[model samples]
Target: MLTSSHCAIEIVAMAALRQKQAFEGELNRIAGTRLTLEAQVNAIETANLNAETMIAMKKGAEALKGIHGNMNINKVDATMDQIREQMDISNEISDAISNPVNMGIDVDDEELKNELEELEQEQLNDRLMGAERAPIEDEDDEEAQLRQLQAEMAM
Candidate 1:
């Protein structure tokens, strides 16, 4: 009952509508893919930032550890120096105490025998009383000990 030209026109219109719908669907799919890719990129960027922050913190901790190690080594070196100084002072004191010439009388000198005997007795008395003479252990006590030893040898 339809004419051929009218039927042909209706079929063309239907085909055009189907092609338009397909194009619109394809555009929607492309837009959805773009959104998913953008979300993935943002997530990756956030992860990279977090990784960088963690690396920086680790480097800072390493620097602090290095500083602490250096400080420990310096402390050990300082303690060793102090011990060496104390040993040197002790050796000097011992050498001075053992010298016969520093004792003010030659070992073979019979002419100064009585004077030497008195000096020896005075030194013994000083050793016994020195600790009780100082009320406090102060720098003055160390100075007094050195002066007293020098005086004993001069006698």
Candidate 2:
């Protein structure tokens, strides 16, 4: 009777130990699966952050490019307007110089010309008046007188 009871107790303890080992193995497998899922979640979050950053950078670059393009167009238009204005001014100057008579410009100074003519007439009158003086004695008559004196001395 004692031997049979002892064998029965050993059999029950062995069964209980196998059940504990199987439970521990199942717990270990569940823990490993949870850790693997957590790692995948972290990796996905990092990838999402990088993607969002790249998208925002692209948007900013596009916006700046559009603004710069508009500014360049405006600058070009302003420069062209200035060039056109300069060309118009140059053409006006050329036309004004080409047709001075039509623009009421006097080519000659009439007052200055009249004054110069009056002065020339006055000088001519003065010269004519000077020419009316008595005629000068001839140098030849004086030389003949000197020669007659020298002949008288010689005699």
Candidate 3:
């Protein structure tokens, strides 16, 4: 039979060993959990970085689109300005041609009148020659005939 004091001592030593083992197991579990948590955190951070990069790229693309749109608008405005300038020039030329006083004319002087008449005749001749040189097309009649031919072909 064992003594009570010896039994108590043996029980105390076993309890201490069990406690130490439990503590070590808990520490290992905590370490594993902490490692897993760190890995998940790193994965999330990488995903966040990727998302941010994509967003920045999207913004850059949008900015490029806006710039392209603005460039198109500017091109249109430039073309309109050119057309307006051409129209203004045409108006100025027409005005100059129509105004006899602007042609350095003294209508009261007979010699100047004769010179103006000669100049006017020359201008009329040039206009006639230009008209004769232009190709004359009866567009409406030609288009109607083309349509009729197309209809006949379809039939």
User: lDDT for every model?
Assistant: 0.91, 0.91, 0.92
Worst 10 residues of 2 by lDDT: 99-108
Give residue 88's error in model 2 in angstroms. Answer: 21
Model 2 stretches with alpha carbons more than 4 Å out:
72-155
lDDT per residue for candidate 2 within 1-155, as digits (tens), equals 56988989989999999999999999999999999999999999999999999999999999999878667777989999999999999999999888747456555788879999999999988887889685677779879899999999999
Model 2 reaches what TM-score against the true structure? 0.44
Clashing pairs in 1: none
- TM-score winner between 1 and 3, please give it: 1
TM-score: which candidate is best? 1
**Candidate 2 residue-wise lDDT at 109:** 84
Error of 1 at 117 (Å): 54
True lDDT of residue 57, candidate 2? 100
lDDT score for residue 37 of model 1: 99
lDDT tens readout by residue for model 1, 56-131: 9999999999978667777989999999999999999999888767556445577578888999999988886876
Model 2 error, position 92 (Å):
24
